[model samples]
Target: MAISRITTVEVTSEHIGVKGEPNISYIYSRYYRAPELIFGATKYTTAIDIWFAGCVLVELLLGQPLFPGESGVDQLVEIIKEKCVEEDYEI
Candidate 1:
């Protein structure tokens, strides 16, 4: 299968929170979360959505999530692993 285009459907509720409020409870899906969100950044831009779009595109290309994590920590681990591999650094 091939992905010609990607569309942003309804934004997840995790991305919706009151400004200046502590965003410790809700979070985006682990597989598609942006790095900042993973790092507990409550103040972020729409770029997070763009990051999620990129992840979805990658999933479409690879036939699976590029980051298939089970939890927040697991998600960070997957990202770190990918970064280490890319930089040719030992983890």
Candidate 2:
């Protein structure tokens, strides 16, 4: 499988793990959610996570995400219809 640019990865049922971004984020600190990711002292005095939990809670009541996508960028786009700018899309 390594030939012709094809590759194979082996996994066991018990070894399953997520292959993309981490959900835990200093950037995604629970106290901030708006049009963009805000950092630093701006993250203070606002219960950002509480807001997100409220949003998700509402979505759950509706039986779906208020917004959903196949990737994190897609998910963000669904949120505000704008791309997350200046990201270095590298491994």
- For model 1, the superposed segments whose C-alpha errors exceed 4 Å read 2-27
Error of 2 at 63 (Å): 0.7
Give a tens-digit lDDT track for model 1, residues 41-70.
Answer: 876566765887898878878877888888
Give per-residue CA lDDT, model 2, range 1-91, as digits (tens): 1222322334455433233423223343222243333222332223544556665565546555555555555555555542333364321
The window of 10 residues in a row where model 1 has the poorest summed lDDT is: 19-28
Per-model TM-score, in order, reads: 0.67, 0.37
Q: Give RMSD (Å) of candidate 2 vs. truth.
A: 15.0
Relative to the true structure, candidate 2 reaches a TM of 0.37
lDDT of each: 0.73, 0.41
